[model samples]
Target: MEQDVFRLHYEATQARVEEALREQIGRMGRYADLREAMEYSLMAGGKRIRPVLVLESCRMCGGDPETALPFACAVEMIHTYSLIHDDLPAMDDDELRRGRPTNHMVYGEATAILAGDGLLTAAFQALTQADLTAQQRVDAVACLSLAAGPEGMVGGQAMDMAGEGRSLTRSELEQLQSLKTGALIAAAAELGCIAAGGSPEQREAVRRYAQCLGRAFQVQDDILDVTSTDEELGKPTGSDREKEKNTFVSLLGLERSRELVEELTAQAVAALDGFSSRDFLVWLANTLAQRTK
Candidate 1:
């Protein structure tokens, strides 16, 4: 039963994301080359998990998924932008992403950089154009800005760069991962609340749930990097170890990290206890913790 819900949400959200990507890309008039490059990277395969979170959260709050689609796409664009930049030659220096050549590898460094920039700007544009109440728009914009801004994803990236090749306390590592990875996930949930006109208390509940899920998601990713193959992960595995980056799996044993993931998953599900529409969210949280990729 839970698997059915997961599969349904996953497939439905995937289709929505693809449609949004096509529509968004089509609007990029002129500068056709840059637009193509941007679309290439954006359309590159991903699980579309962030956008799905946005839609699911809105659905759980008794909102229309159609109304939430723009914000959902916006979050995905931001996530894709981060990935493009993260794979840059001066950054992670990754040669592959989503089982294909990195943006820089195919489009050149300058083009890749521009592609990332375009996607970031486009995300805000998409959010601003969402068909929502003025207040909802304002809140959604604020949530997205905070998640993508210096206090969140960018700050986290800075910390990650600083911590590379250095030892970090478990707390410090968690903090960095929370900001870098968890912020966007939390924003997904928060935007859903805004779109649904949820009360502050309800939004807070969803935020907490997403935060726990995001932490567990990142830790599981770390574990997969050590244990899964590149094909299975859709990117290079063991890259963290190769770069000597501190990860949960590096600081804690694999068994310990797995245990932590299960604990976090429980906390995430527990956060949704009072919500009336929680079945899909619960299933998503559990599936994320246990996924091979």
Candidate 2:
């Protein structure tokens, strides 16, 4: 398929996921202030890649997107919550995200923290409400819980914090990226498999694909930080340098980083060979490898 066709598919899926997100958020309990803050960041414009991955992975498994919408929204909520907390004064301390003020910058530290907390817990609620079988829901919940828990994303974050202002070896950086970013991406793909009642072999294949794609995603992000403008990125540029962080770009330079992305993209695409209808997933990996933002 042409790039234009893939772009259209991505846009359409993104819109659908956005609507699902709004509906899920609307069902939240009445806590005006907390809800407002939560909505502020949750509704903030993003690529919605995680949710798209969920929907697309389900499609790849011959499952219905409607059946996957709940899990898709849940992953996005978790992602949005992570971004809110990551932008706090104590974290990256950025004042901008998705071309607007950071959640804490606009809503205050307390509300921002609460908003992140709300979204985090809401993710589980969203999972519980997914339209899957009892056993499927149980498996999906367990998968997501492991990915978001202390041993996964949280642990990766802790390592990231510990490595701040210090140069890390390539292996250490890869380990951090695998947990902090790759874990959730892996879960998104895994959730799609679980939601679709995919066979164990299919589940493992997408997991491998997501692992490579997730690392590529982060590598591209690092590329964008230096190469993309704040307008394109919707956030401050050169932040990695400003924070003195060890990113793929910083460690490998532009040329080498691009090579790494290509390598990972190929690996991700190859992992999809176990499936018959994987054009979208393949195109997505290549597109992400070359994305500016």
Candidate 3:
């Protein structure tokens, strides 16, 4: 697998997910203003890595991309909602995201909050309408619910807020991020496996892979917060320091953080060995480790 080939595939997958998101959003609800707010944030794009992981993992496990499309879009919707809420004045209080004004800045705080709620509910609706067995749908809903609910990302956010202005131990920081970041990523891979009707062994391997990749991604982001420009990050740099929150680069030195990234990347790639076709996932893990933004 050439880097060029992987790049092409990655772009194509991102496009596919966005297209599905746009199409599905049109059908989400009839309230024009609400839909406008929802569309604003949902279409404000990023790498679409989460949805891409869902589709690719499904394909890798011998499922049709179409079969995974709705769920992938659902995951993207959930992610976008989280971002909207995370940027509110009560949260990170940032005014910029993805090189544009934050949702609250553009749409007012009330609409921004409703927009996030709308997207969250719409995501669950998409899940209910997905083409899966009754049992599969039940399990998928349950898994994603746990990942997005107070038990996972929300819980981690609570810990983050509580730990603000205080130094967290390395283990405590890892525990927080594992839920805040790693949980949904792990769910993305597991959902793909479920979508494909993959074996239990395959599910475990991909989940392990996603967990490491998610951690590496966050660690690199923490590193970037210190080293990259605001232009590169599309938001304020040194935010971790401003908030006095513990990060990989904060808990561990820059040199030590880089070492951990290397370790995590290796572990992530190793977890994919069981799959016969894993070049993209491998390349993806390594590329994320070295990303500038």
Report the poorest 10 consecutive residues by lDDT, candidate 3. 28-37
How do the residues 1-293 of candidate 1 rate in per-residue lDDT, one tens digit apiece? 76886698689788987898789878873584798789888898688888888988998888998898889989999999899999998989999888899999998999989999999999988888889988898889899999999999999999999899999999999999999999999999999888888888889999999999999999999999999998998888999999999999989989999999999999999999889989988988988888998
What are the lDDT figures for the candidates, one per model?
0.91, 0.91, 0.90
RMSD of each: 1.0, 1.0, 1.1
Using all chains and alpha carbons, the TM-scores for the candidates as numbered come to 0.98, 0.98, 0.98
Candidate 1 residue 48 C-alpha distance from true site, Å:
0.5
In TM-score terms, candidate 1 sits at 0.98
lDDT (Cα, tens digit) per residue for candidate 3, span 1-293: 58999999999999999889999888965775788889988998899999999999988887887787878988889899999999999988989989999899988999999999999988888877778777767777898999989999889989988888888899999999999999999999888888888889999999999999999999999999999999988988998898887999988899999999999999999999989889899999999999999
Q: lDDT per residue, candidate 2, 80-155, as tens digits?
A: 9998998889988889988899999888999999999999999988988987998988888899889987888888
Model 3 regions more than 4 Å off: none
Question: Would you give me the overall lDDT of model 2?
Answer: 0.91
Off by over 4 Å in 1: none
